[model samples]
Target: MTRTLVVVGHGMTGHRLAERLRALDTSGAWRIVVLAEEAHPAYDRIRLSSYLTGGSRQDLALAGRDFTEDPRVDLRLGCAVVSGDRAERTVRTADGEQLPYDALVLATGSEPFVPPVPGRDLANCFVYRTFDDLDAIRGAARRGRPCVVVGGGLLGLEAAHALRLLGMRPHVVESASHLMPTQLDAGAARVLHRSATGLGLRLHCGTAVASIEAGPDGAVRAVVLGDATVLESDLVVFAAGIRPRDELAAALGLERGERGGVLVDENCRTADEHIWAVGECAAVQGRCYGLVAPGYGMAETVAGRLAGRSPRPFDGTDTSTSLKLLGVHVATFGIIHPRGGPAAEAVFAEGTTRYAKVFLEPESGRLLGGILAGETGSRTALGPFVGHRPPADLEQLLLP
Candidate 1:
């Protein structure tokens, strides 16, 4: 008998789950129903900044008409699941339509985290997230005007570069001591800092935003820092962080992670047997992953289970990240900073235009993690050797 699979969100991970299940269910064992909150179909959110720089919406789209028009798939755009009756195996949408499902998967994804600073709600303040958010920012952007971006991480830097493309002077404010603190060490951050300044972007590190000061018109006028410095600006973009969109979990009475996500087992299954979760909204084994790769892994795991295939258990996948920010290459793999007092030893190298460091297992030279900045061509070769000993010609691999 064919079963109905109801998916709550149609973001990247949710879309992947449906695609994977469709590929595995060649016998037509399951019919998929995807309800997306956004009016548009799933798009490539990783390249969202490209939308600001001459890339059309079509360029960032992940799902085409072919996928959406699949006979076995029911794709409903602008439909949001408001509540669910777990015992009844049914979900209610915002439009008052009820959906019955043999199984349900939640992929609600995440939202931009805006700090609780005063005047943040004033006009000209934005958060870098969806296509709509980018549209709003572009509408408000003024050429040659100062735009302050709160958060010095990957997304923050990306937003800054986008603002630069819009001809605005971008200033980055990072609460952490260095940029990309979660991924890069002090040495690597210095290299990134030089690159950023070289591109005419201003940096304000190691300080928090005291508050967003509004002008007489109630729009952004200046940003006050915790150190008592004031930066005059007309626009502010908050890319501080992201919080999982698990608000519906409360209505459904599902358990949540300590940090705020639907708590799931290694298989991405919640306490309810019929319900599963994937993407940034799920906390597998008490931890939540914010990267796209881990979310994809979760989607694959759940898809395999639904397809009746015995897939690999989802303990956790590699959290390594390799990306180019503002034309500067940065990559971090495995464990850049291990816990418990730096048990691993690191081999460091520096050059005129690059910086590289590799952490070894201290005894057998097993690769623990590494950081690359400026010239990151070696990331592709070094990433696979994580947790294993690398090639004997390690010295040559570090060369720029």
Candidate 2:
């Protein structure tokens, strides 16, 4: 019997789920329909900031950009699934179209969080999320104009770098005591702050945005800090954080996490068997993953289940990240800071070239996790060592 599968959302995870299912389901027992809210099909959202530099919209495409050619696939771009009727096994679109499905998968992903502040709705104010948002910012940015980016996390720093690439001076405002406080410890954050400052980025750590002041024409003019200091700005970008898009899940009465995400089991299945959840929208064990790697893992898990194959249970993710942030090579994996415990620790720093730290089991010398900044050539050898014992000469192996 041929079954119908309706996938809600066409982001990277959604696209990945479709690809995985197609590759696994060689018997052709199921036909798939992908509903995407965005006008364009799925693209590499991780490189969204790259569009501001030299990368084009087409360069960020996931796969070959054409899934419609597949006989078993129905790709519907700019079509949003407005609601679900579980008993009827049907979903309604925003355009008042109804589609029936034997099974439904929710991969609605997440939305950018904008902090509520006065003048946040000003003309030149923006949130860094989509290509459209970047285009809007690019249109408003002028050479020598000053831009204020709220939040010093990865996205905020990316936005600052994008603005700098657009020929604008950027000021980063972070409420936390240090930049990337959640990702990096205080010591690493200090080093990052120095690197960012050397790159001509103005950093305002431990500062709160009291309000955004606009000009007479209602465009951004300045950002007022908690200490009454004003940062002159022609543009203001909010990259505070992200919140999962779980409105459909909420409306369907699905269990949710305390922090607002659709609750799912190890199989990525919701309370109802016919419906499954994955990606940022699905919160497994009461925790939602905001990173792409975990979301990709969830997508793969759900795809395996849909393929009717005995796949391994979804058991969380490593939460490790390796990327270049504003020309700085930064990599953090496992437990960078462990509570008082018996773990072998090694620290190596070579001036401005690199700062590397690794944690290992005391007796077995098994690698747990570590942090690498500046020169991360050691990441190649150290990354695979996670969860396994390194070579006996591990200390010499990490030399820059």
Best by lDDT: 1
Per-residue lDDT of model 2, residues 1-400, tens digit only: 9999999999999999999999999999989999999998899988888898778999998857356689899999899988878888899999999899998999999998888888889999898888898888888999998899999999999989888888899999999999887677665676677788888899998988999998888889899999899999999999888899999986677889899888889888988999988898888878888888888888888888888888887866467788888667888887665546757877867665566778887877778888777755556677787889777766566654
- In model 1, pairs of residues that clash are none
Per-residue lDDT of candidate 1, residues 1-400 (tens digit): 9899999999999999999999999899999999999998899988999998779999988888878889999999999999999989999999899899999999999999999999899999999988889999999998999989999998999999999989999999999999988788778888889889999899999999999998999999999999999999989999999999998789799999999999999999999999999999999987888888889999999999999899998856457788888677888777766655564655555643677788877777788878888865567788788879877776577653
Best candidate according to TM-score: 1
TM-score of each: 0.96, 0.93
lDDT of each: 0.89, 0.85
TM-score of 1: 0.96
| Candidate 2: C-alpha lDDT | 0.85
What does the lDDT read for residue 105 in candidate 1? Answer: 97
Question: Poorest 10 consecutive residues of model 2 by lDDT?
Answer: 391-400
Instruction: For residue 215, give model 1's deviation from the true position in Å.
Output: 1.1
The residue ranges of model 2 lying beyond 4 angstroms of the native Cα positions read 63-66, 335-346, 351-353, 361-365, 389-392
